[model samples]
Target: MSSDDHGLLPAELAEAARPAIAEARGKPARDAARILAEAGLTGVCAQEDDGGMALGLSFALAIAEEAGAGQLRFPLLDQILLAQAFAGQDIAGRIAAGEALGVIGWEGARDGLLRLSDDCDCDVVLVPTGQGADLIERAGLTATPTPLLDPDAPQIWLDVGAARKIGSLSGEQMADLRRAGEALYGGFVTGAAANALALSSDYLAARVQFGRPLSSKQAVRHHLARMKLLLEMSRAALARSLARDELGNPRDTRPAFLGAVGNAIWTLEKAIHLHGGMGFTWEVPLHYSLRDIRKIETAFGAGRLARQVAQDFIRAA
Candidate 1:
């Protein structure tokens, strides 16, 4: 969000995706993402011919960061990242065929039956009920029935089993996918903070106060300055991760992930604080930006990621 340090996005992809997003709500959103994911992004894995993207994590990452900036949400990262966890398998192909909806349970971080867990034009549920982890299911998914904080996102419930669907991905690979998802999610949250910052900054600049504009006040200036710092840091985090991913270096990802989540959390939080009272109101989308970013930070495991990084460093010593 901050110009202090900026990362580049794929202009062609973003431009192409705009119309698709404009027409799509929920199901349509999923479809467009699937199309993009299945089309050329499959190479993200080591073996491109094997339904892997082989595109390197950085390129895939650029897509994620851009998605975040759009105020758009879709399942591209979830599905592709999960597909990588199933390397050498036909999972990506199935997703391409529209047989599978990219989904996973966010609670407890466990795998299961995935009953009626998917909705919005998806063909399958993929739930975690009393049954177990099931990759395939036609129906019998129940709706969680929440009003939904995100218009683009809806909630669902389903039965699930304790375990199953573990694939060729070794523990390391599985861990990598989880981290990748977290990093991308963090980038998303970062984008939301950015969108809010832009809007808030513009409003403050034009609003007259104390015979001039709030911009003239020292207090407001300091807040805006910090906001700028947050945005720059977010960009740095995102760029670092993307470069590491592109280099195919896993070691570099650790700090990258950490910084991404941290940047987003602080960036969005600062935006809220800067907006003052208006930021808290429902009419203002700033609150939603904060909320959505919080969800991403929650998934990225702000606390867990920090702990794991420290633990890894200790063990390495």
Candidate 2:
């Protein structure tokens, strides 16, 4: 279904989300959560009874893009997914109301240790199980921080031995959550790339060398053109992934997600390259986008995801 079919345009939602997301940036986790929830972003896909807007994943995808572009540190994606996943539960209501925070262990299992996206200050974590997933209380788990990539917001490892199960999702619900995650994350990286492209383009246009803008150089122009091309393609791929096929079945999202990651990495790297010496410095914000995209790439195992997509195509052929 199209954005229009949802009775709310994605662009409109994105415009509405930008200010709130920007406000939430650099704030404490709970404060950010309050800002986002008040703006109706944390529960965009949740049930109305749970204090959500009761929208679909497409709306959430728009919000995710805004979050990514703003470099929001909070786990907005996890909050939205969990709120919807746990629909009728009090936890869902709490999450939607910004009274509680939730995160997901994107990798590993509940039997041992699970890997979360980042050092999110959360109240509960959803860990994978044999059937689906269990929402375990964070107070009961031990969190080990991995600050190699992003020291400000590091990846976290959780020891998962018999934490309190506050909620659960069936296998089907987990599958749905995964699909929505792919689409939302695709939107996210695309947004990050878009920001990087804008920053690079603006910088190049204004940074004059030899009495002419650096953007006037053929080689520099070529690089900017390629970045723009890839960014647009990634956006298109993400949009296509969110749409149903002609058979009215959900389209496979792996290709789009993988493609977005690769494209974002390339765009971010090129953006840094275009900035020359300043790109390597902490003063320039381009590296943050690069780091974020790389973290996502590592989390998803882009190489493995691409191979899986290829294998599926080969079998169908």
User: Each model's TM-score?
Assistant: 0.72, 0.95
Worst 10 residues of 1 by lDDT: 108-117
Put down candidate 2 lDDT per residue, 173-206, tens digits, no spaces: 9877877888888888888888888888899999
Please write out the lDDT profile of model 1 over residues 1-317, one tens digit for every residue: 21211353344544544454433323464566555554444234324445554544555565565556655555555665655555566665555433455565533224432322224544433332233323444344434533354444544444434333433344455456655666666666666666766876887788787778777888878877777787777667766654534556654455665665666666666666766787676677676656566555554446776788889889999
**Superposed Cα RMSD, model 2:** 1.8
Cα-based lDDT for every prediction: 0.55, 0.84
TM-score of 1: 0.72
State in Å the error of residue 179, model 2: 0.7
Which is the leading candidate under lDDT? 2
